[model samples]
Target: LTRYDRMMARRRPKKGQAASKGYREAKKWRAKTYAKIARQRQDTGRKWAKKAVTDHDAIAVEDFRPKFLARSSMARKAADAAIGATKKALVEMGRKHGRDIRLVHPAHTTMDCASCGARTKHALPLSERTYTCTACKVVSPRDKNSARVMLVRAGLNPAGVEGVRPPGALLPEAA
Candidate 1:
């Protein structure tokens, strides 16, 4: 879609010729494409939000501002993720289902030790999938550890949370 938009931009009609056939066709196509993408994004957001609200008694998500993220270098990817739409859907679903939905501050949630409450001294890059806390020696997947942190920030005990599997525990495969 971006490439198409760029290509069409170079061939856009001059000023005072906005009613040209080519310009009309390009404008229509652009509008249609944008609408299609929006529909797909909305559908996906609603489905995941409904699933999350239905499956979990409580949910703790990062309080992220999509508009701020969209100003970064990863604007295109951020926009494609549709963070605002997903968050809106989640909030709506939570309200409808009477489920607890906490939006914790996103700062250092991924870097802080969930077990020790100490932020890691060194920067953890995206390539580092495993998070090993130096202060407490608690090791787990980065995502799992971040989630545990969020749970704690939301004033919940991570151990008491249902369906929280132990780190590195093996599960039986479905037959």
Candidate 2:
């Protein structure tokens, strides 16, 4: 919401007759503010990502493209999240070590019943944090459930039994 307000206020293109030296100055100020916010978010993401990759031998996270989210109504908020920055930082950090960074598929990660393995349509509003499945009665944090689905995609069962690792489970092996 703030990002949208900020972006709108800052990036409005000048119209004919409304354009003036003063108006140009105001636009520049707003643009600068928006850019500053973006940089701050990216900086924070980079710091956290660096820590995760440095500390953990293996990191499992949802594999998502920020561009797809950018096309949504929540574009501004998604941009503010700096997902690309974090992933970039993690990849570089992981490369420095002999570690792996996993980005599991996001499909049905949240809606699929982790207990019964039944897929169902889950249309939980973004405001809702709790996920209550109607079919299998699996209840858990929305993000955690998604993570569990991702783990399953990587062939790791909910009970923690290891299996064949999924593609991209680790950083690409050196040729």
Instruction: Give per-residue CA lDDT, model 1, range 59-93, as digits (tens).
Output: 88888765554456645664746987798889889
In candidate 1 the C-alpha lDDT for residue 146 amounts to 94
* Candidate 2 Cα outliers beyond 4 Å, as residue runs: 1-19, 67-81, 125-141, 155-175
Q: Give each model's whole-structure lDDT.
A: 0.82, 0.66
Report the lDDT of model 1 for residue 82: 92
Clashing pairs for predicted structure model 1, backbone only: none
**lDDT digits (tens) for residues 1-175 of candidate 2:** 3554565556556675455565466666667877887788778877887767665566666775665554566665566367766777677677777676677776667677666667766567778787777777878888767666776776655555334344444544642
Candidate 1: C-alpha lDDT: 0.82
**What TM-score do all the candidates reach, one by one?**
0.82, 0.61
RMSD, every candidate, angstroms = 3.9, 8.5
